[model samples]
Target chain A: MKDEAMALRDTHVTLAHGGGGQAMRDLIDEVFAAVFQPPGMEDQARLAPGALAEAGARLALTTDAFVVTPLEFPGGDIGKLAVCGTVNDLAVGGARPLWLSAAFIIEEGTEVALLRRLVATMAEEARAAGVRIVTGDTKVVGRGAADGVFITTTGVGVIPAGREVSTGQVRPGDVVIVNGVLGDHGACILAARGDLMLSTDLVSDCAALGHLMEAVLAAAPGVRAARDATRGGIAAVLNEIAGVAGVGIEIDEAAVPLRDEVRGVCEILGLDPLYLANEGRLVLFVPEDEAGAALAAMRTLPEGAGAVVIGRAVAAHPGQVRMRTLFGGSRIVDMLVGEQLPRIC
Target chain B: MKDEAMALRDTHVTLAHGGGGQAMRDLIDEVFAAVFQPPGMEDQARLAPGALAEAGARLALTTDAFVVTPLEFPGGDIGKLAVCGTVNDLAVGGARPLWLSAAFIIEEGTEVALLRRLVATMAEEARAAGVRIVTGDTKVVGRGAADGVFITTTGVGVIPAGREVSTGQVRPGDVVIVNGVLGDHGACILAARGDLMLSTDLVSDCAALGHLMEAVLAAAPGVRAARDATRGGIAAVLNEIAGVAGVGIEIDEAAVPLRDEVRGVCEILGLDPLYLANEGRLVLFVPEDEAGAALAAMRTLPEGAGAVVIGRAVAAHPGQVRMRTLFGGSRIVDMLVGEQLPRIC
Candidate 1:
C-alpha cells in the first residue's frame, strides 16, 4: 500500500481521481484513507457517545471555508489554518471539539505533493487538538475552475452542561480581554504575498486555542462569552458583541498589545491593525471580578501569553464601540463597511 | 430586514461581502441568515440532544463537496442537490439525518440574484427533508479563481440502536435492488451543457431519499447493506461492494430499468448507461427472502416507483461483478477507469 501511494505521489491529480472509479479509489485509499484510517468503509462515520451522553450537554456545529492565497505561508499553511479556524470556532463557544469532517475541492493538475503536505499538517493539528478527522469527500474540477485547492472543514463539539456562552450574554459591566497581540497573521500574509515589495519575518499567529480556552474556562467560570478575532479581526468581533448585547464597548488604545513589525506593516499599508485578521487571537468577556483570573490563566499558555484587558462593556452609546487614543482623543470603531484585505484567512 | 435584503440583490457579489465586516454581515443576514434562521449568532450552533440520547445510538457524520457546473439544470439546482446528496449519504447508512452545516466558496462578481435563488432552494429542501441548516460560513474568491459557487455540506445523523449497514456485510446469497431508473442525472447534465448538441427533456433524478430509506428499513429488517449509485453510477457501487465483501455479483441486464431518452443519450455519446451517474438511486443488498418486502416498501414512494431486482451476490469469481446480457452472454462489468462525466453531482 505504501509503495502504491508513493508511486501515485509522483504525478499531479487528474479528474479520474474524482470520478468514483478505480483511480478515485486508489487515490482515496493510498492518499487519504491511509492517513485518516477511518474505522469503517461506510458512507458515514459511526461515533460512539461521549460528552453528548451527559445530561444537558448540547452539540456544537460549525463550518468554515479556507481559500487563502499562497496555500503555503510563513508560519503555517492552509491546512493548519483550516483546522485551527474550525477548532477555535467551537472552543470559543465553550464546546470541546471532538470530530471534524474535511472536504476538499481540488483543481485538476494540482501537485500530489502539495496535497500530502496539507493532509499531513491537518492530521498533526487534529492530533494536537485531540480531535478526529473521521469523514471527508473530495471533488476535482477542471483547471482554472478552482484556485489550486480549497478546503471546507466542518467541526462537531459538545458543550458541557451549564456552560453557556454567547455575545448576548455579555453585560454592560463585563470586562473585555484578548489572548494575545493583534494582526500578526494579516501582516504575515501581506509580506508573504510580496506584492507590496515589503519584507518581514513575521509568522502567522495560527494555533489551536482549544487547550488554552479550556484552561481559562476552568479558572474563570464567570466568563460571559468568548469570540475568536478572526476575519474581521478584533474590530469586527467587538462590533458584533456590542450590537448583539445592546451595549457600548470602550477600549484604551495604549492597552492593546502589538508587535513592532506588525504595526509597521499596517502603517505602511495605511491599514488599522485592529481590523487585520488573526488566527489565534480571541476576545473574552468576563465579569469584572473574574477578569484577573481570566488574565492569569491565559498568561500561562503560550497561545495566550500576551493576554491583556483592551476594553470593557459600557451602558453609554448602546450598540457601538469606541477607542480612546493615547493623545486623549476618542473615536468610534464601527464595523468595517467594505473589503480591507481579501481572503486573509 | 427584507427591504435591506431586497436592495442588495441588484448587484454582484464583491470581496467586501466575504471580508467579515458590515458588508459580509449584510449579505449573510439578508441572503442566508434570514432564510436559514439559525438559532443564534454564535460561531457554533448549539443543538439540543435528540435521538442521540437513546441508549446505544451512535452519531453519524459525513461531508461532501459539490462543484456541479452550470449551477442549475432541469428538476433541480446545486442547492437542492447539495441537501439531497448529504441527506442520502446518511440515510443509506441507516442513520436519521438531523442537522447539516453548509459552507460556500463563491467567486467574486457572481450575481447576488443567483445566490438568493440557491439559498431559497436550500431552505425549501431542508424543510421537506426534515433537517436544519444550523450553521454555515461563506468565502469569496476573485473572479476566475472559482467557476461560480461551490458548496460543501457536512451532515450529522443518529444511527438508532441495533442498526448497522456496511458494504462488507454483503453475503453471497443477498439480492440486489435499486430504487429507480438510472442515468437521467448524467444525461440531463449532458443536455444542459449543450456541448454535444443533444436535446432532451430528461430531468436530473435528484431527490431526498431519507424517507424512502426509512420506510424500506422498517419493512425489510433483514437488509444487509445499501449504497447510493452516484458518481461512477451502479457499476462503481457494485465493484466496491464486491471488492469489499469478496463476493461475486451477477446482474440481469434485461431487468435493469432505463429511460429511453437516457439510453439514447448514452448511445449517441458512446457511453455505457450503467456507468452514468444518478442523483436519486441506490442499490440495496437484502436477504433473498426479504427482497419482495424491500421492493414493495420502496415502490410506495414516488422516488422509488421503478424499484426492481437487477442483481444477486454469488460465490463464483470472488471480488468481481458480471452482467448477464440480453443476448444470454455474460460479460465482466468492471469499475470505471477514467472521467466519464465530470461534476455530474
Candidate 2:
C-alpha cells in the first residue's frame, strides 16, 4: 500500500491520467469536474451523458490555449485568463455557454497552492459566467519541459433557435460600430507590469461578454457582424469582414473610441491604437439603413453605452481595409504581424 | 499591391493574422482558404456561422503542437512527424478529417526546402489519410527565438451520431485487450535518431486508428473503453480504466505483448517497455462474457490480427491497477509521473 501510494505520487503526468484512470478519474472529479461544470451537470462521475438535455437548450463550444508569460500577473493570473478567454470567445460567438473542458500542461512542481488557486478561480469564473465545468485534463511535464502552466479550454454552448447572425452577411455601406472602450486590456496589462502609469485608475478589461452580446443579439437581424477585438483591435476585424465580403472598409479614426488612459499609454508606447488589443469590447457591422437603430439598441445596454459608428464597407477595393486619417489621408489597415506585447490577451 | 505583398512577407510571425486584418484576411484566403477547399465548401471569405461550423466539423478537430528536437531524424522530420502525428490523432478519434489548420513558429532561416517538404508531406499525409490541407499559418522568429518550427495542427470532424465514446465507462471484470506490439512508437523514434542501433528495422507504429476503431465498434457494444496508448503506454491506460470504473485491474505481464526487438532496446535504454509509447495500437476494455466475441471481431479487422487479452478488471482494491508476474507476485501500476520525453507526440 505504501509503495502503491508512492507510485501514485511518482507516476505524475501519464497518458493514463488523461486515459480516465484513477489519475484521470481523480483529476476529473477532484479538480476539473468541480470547477468547470455548468449548472445541472451532475452525474459527471458516470459515463452517461449528464444533465445536458435538461437545461441544455442553450450551448456553445469554443476552445483556445493560453501560453502567456509570467504565469501570475496583476489584476488576473493565467487560470483566470484561461477560463475568461474561452468564455468571451463563446460570448462574442453568440451562445449561452453551459459546459467547459480545460486541458492543462503543468510543469512538474507547479505549486499545489497555485494550482488550487487557479482551480478555485476557474470555478469562480465559471460560476460568475453562470456556466458549469463538467470535464478537464492535467498533464505533467519533465523539468525544463515548460514553464508553469499552459491551459487549453474548450467550451460548449447552445444558441436558441431564430437568432442567426454572421460575418459573411456584412454588406457594403454597413456601418462599423464598437461598444464602449478599446485598448484597455492591453494598456492595463502594460501598466500592471509597471511599463506605464495610468492617469485614471486602470484595470485589465478582462471580463465575460455573454451579457453584452445577448443585449445586442436580442435586438435582432440588423446586426451584421460582431467581434471581440482581442489581438488586433477594430481595424483587424473590419478588414476581415471586408476581405470576406469582397468590399473595402473605411474607418473614421476620430470616431473610433478609445479610453483616454489607453490612448495616452498607446501614444507613449508609440503603438498604433488600432493595433492594440481589447478584451471587454465589441465591434459591430450594421447596415447603413439600420445604423441608427443599431446604435440606439447598443446605447440602451450597459455593456454598449459608448457605441458609435466608426466605419463603413464600400464596394471598391474589395477585400481591403483602410482608415481615414485625422489629417484626411487614408492608410491601409492590416492585421497584427507578430507577438505584439505577448500575453496581452 | 507590391507593398502589401512585401509587408505580408516581411513580418515572420505577426499577431495580425489572428487579428482579422488585411494580413489576417490575406493569410486566410491565400494560405488557408485556397488550399483547404474540398468540393462542397465555398470560399465564403467571411466569419459566417456556417463557415466556422464547417471549419470546425468538416475536419477532425484535433489540435497538437510539435516541439520535437533534432528536428530532422530517422523515419521522419519534424514537419512530416507533426502532420502524421495530428492525422493519427484524428484518425483514432473517429473523424473523417476533412481540413486542417497549421500554425507554425519557425526559428529564423529554417531551410525553406525543409518547410516545403514538410508542407508537401503534410499534403501527402493528408492525401494518404484521405483528408485535406485547407488552412495554414507561418511565423518567422529571430535566431534562437524558437526551435526550427513548431506546428500546431487543429483538425475538424463531424461526429456521426451514436459513435462518440469515452474512457469513463470500463466496467469491473471487463477484459483488457490491445492491438499488436507496444512501445514501437517510442522505440522507433529513439532508434531513428541513431543514438542506439540495437535494431535497424525499427519503424514507427504511427498510423491512423479510425478504421480499426470503427471495425471494433461495429463488432460490440460490450466494449466499454477504447484509447490509443500514446504517451504513457499500456500500463497508463489500464490504470486509467481501473480508476474510472472504481475497480482494480490485473494484467498478466506475460500476456501483455511486446516486440522482441523493442524489449531488447528498452533493456539497453534502462526504460521499462510498459512505459514506452505506441502510436498505432489501441487498448480496449470489454465485458468478460463478450471478450471472446470482441476478440473475434477485432481479429477480423485490418489493424487487429495480433489482438489478445492482456488483463482483467477485479473488484479488489478499487481504483488500483495491478500486474501479475509470471511467478505470481503482484506489482501496482500507476499513471506516468511526468513526461517520459518532452515533445514526443
Candidate 3:
C-alpha cells in the first residue's frame, strides 16, 4: 500500500516523463513495476543501465496505434483498446505476452482530465493483461496533430520455439472456424458515430483473448492457423489464407454466427457483416479431423462459446474465397475496398 | 519468383487483409518479404502448429505513431520518420533491433501515390537500418476518421546481458553528454509548417541511431545511461534523470551545442530550445572518469561528431535540474509545459 501511494504520487506519467530520467524511474518503478514485470530483459540489463531486470522470456514483438474516434467508446476506450489490441496480437501469435512501451500523440487542446482517465484505464488494462507498461514517449500536436488522443503500444512477448504457426501452413480441407459472432466492434463504432440513426442496444465485442486461445491450443494440437478478426472480417481472412496457400475457400454463410441485432443494424447501414470488424473474436483454421475438437475446446472458453465451423478450404478456384448464401446462390467473397469502420482499432 | 508474383497478384490487401488468411499471407510475402529478412522470417515458413517460441533474446519493444502533418519535411518524410522513430527507441534502450511491425491508418481521400511513396520510403529506411519490416496492417477510415496518413511502428531488439542502465543510476558528479546538436528536429518541423514564415533552410535531423549507438557502446564501456533527445527535448530528458536518480543535474549553457539556425528559429517563436526535439541524437550519462573517453569516442563517429559534455550530476537539490546561463546565472530547468513543435514525429 505504501509503495502504491508513493508510486502514484511520485510517478504518475507526465510529458517530460518519457524523457528518460528520474521521472522515467518513478514512472517505471511506481506504475510499471506495480503490474507487469519488465525490469530486466536479456542483454538490455547490460546495455540498458536503467532497465529493471533481464526479461527471461524469448521475445515476440507487436506494435499497434489506437485512434478510435470519440476517444471514449462503448465497452472500451482508446486506452483499453491500445493494451488489449497488442495483447491479442501476441496471444494469437502464441506468444506469452510481457512488456509494453507506449507513445502518445495528444492534440494541443486535449482535456487533462480525459488524458488522466485514459492513462489510468491503460494502466488497468495492462495489469488485466498481466503485462507491464514500461517506457513511453509523448508529443502534443497543434490542435491538428490528432483527435483527443492517439496511443501507440508496442509489446514484447516470449514465444516458445516449438509453437510456431503461420498462415502458410493452412492446407486444403482445413475447416475454418470463428470463435464467436462478428461485426460487434464495427457496429459499435457505427453506433458511436450516431449518424447512422442505428439504435439497437449493442456494444463492442472487444475483450482480451489470451486465455481463450490458451484453451484451444491446449485442446487441439492441430490448429493450423489463428488470427483475431479485427479488420477485414472473416471473408478477408479466408481470402488471405487462400492467397497465401494458393488454395480456395468456401463458406456456408448460414453457419457463420451473427447476432440478430447486429444483423439488423448492418442491414440498415448497408454494411456487410463479412466486411465489418470484430475486436475480441478470432478466426481459426484446423484440419478437418480436428475441427470438432477445436470447436469443443473453443466452447470451453467463454469468449469462444459461439464457436462454429463456418467454412472449409477447397482446391477449386485457387486463391479465391467464396460463400454459399442461404438463398442458394454462390458469390465471390471479395476483400473490402475501403474500411467498414475507420479508426476502429 | 513465379510463385511469388502469382501470390502477390491473387491476394490484394483490403480492409480484411489483416484478417489472418491467404490475403494477409499474400500481402506479407508480396510487400514485406520484398523488403525485410528475418531468421526463418519468410512468408511461407510455418510456425509450429501448436508450438510457441519463447523469445531467446533479451527483448525491448517500442511503439510510435507518426502524425507529422505535411507528411513530407526537409531531410525526410513521415515514412522515413516512422521507421527511424521506432528504431531510435530500441537503439537508445541498448537493444539490437531485430524486427519491425507496421500499421497504417489512411483517412478517406488520401492519395494512393503518397501512401505508396511513404511505404517505399519506409522500406528504404528499414533497409538502411538493417532491420526487417516483418508484419504490417493497413486500414482506411472514413473521411473524418483521420487525416492523410498516420503510421504506427513497433520495434523489437535484443539487449545484451550485463548492460542494465536506467535513470535510477544517476550519481552525484556523473557526467552528461549529448551525441549531437539538439532542437534541429523540432525546429525543422516548425520551419516546414511554412505558416511561421520561417525562412531558414534547416532540415530535420531525423535518422536511425542504431549504428551510432552501436559505436558509442562499443567504446564507452563505462557509459551509465543513454536516451534519445526526442519529444519534450533536453530539459525533459534531464528532469527525468534527476527525478529517477534522486540527484541534481547542472548544465553549462555555453557547452550545450545547437545549430545557429535552430537557435534563431526558437528565439523568434518564443520557444525554449531546451524543450525542442532531436531525432538523430542521444543523451549519454557516464561516470566523470569516463566522460572524456565517451565524448572522444562519440566525436570519431559521423553521427557523434557534435558530441558535447553538457553537464554533470550534482548532489545538491536531488530532484532539480539547473542550467547556467551564458552570463553565469543559473535557472531551474523545469519540465516543458507543452510541445514546441506539434506532431513533428
Reference contacts preserved by each model: 0.86, 0.08, 0.19
Please give the distance, in angstroms, between residue B279's alpha carbon in candidate 3 and its true position after superposition.
Answer: 1.6
TM-score of candidate 1 to 2 decimals: 0.98
* Tens digit per residue, CA lDDT, model 1, B123-237: 9999999999999999999999999999999999999999988789999999999998998998899899988898898999999899998999999987899888889999999
| Top candidate, metric TM-score | 1
Give the whole-model CA lDDT for all candidates, comma-separated: 0.91, 0.62, 0.71
DockQ list for all candidates: 0.75, 0.19, 0.25
User: Ten residues in a row with the worst lDDT in model 3 chain B?
Assistant: B43-52
Cα lDDT tens digits for candidate 1, A1-345? 113443354389999988988778877877788888887998789999788988999999999999998899999999999999999999999999999999999999999888989999999999999989999999999999999989999999999999998889999989999988899999999888888999898999999999999999999998899999998899999999998899999999999999999999988889999999999999999999999998999999899899999989999998889999999999989888788899888
lDDT of 2 at A242: 71
Q: What CA RMSD would candidate 1 show? A: 1.7
Candidate 2 Cα outliers beyond 4 Å, as residue runs: A1-33, A37-63, A70-74, A91-99, A107-110, A130-134, A140-148, A157-163, A193-201, A315-343, B1-34, B38-173, B192-200, B315-320, B327-339
Candidates sorted by TM-score, best first: 1, 3, 2
For candidate 3 chain A, the 10 contiguous residues with the lowest summed lDDT are: A42-51
Candidate 2, residues B318-342, lDDT tens digits: the string is 8788889889899878765544554
Among all windows of 10 consecutive residues in model 2 chain B, the one with the lowest summed lDDT is: B40-49
In angstroms, give how far residue A66 of model 2 lies from its true place: 3.1
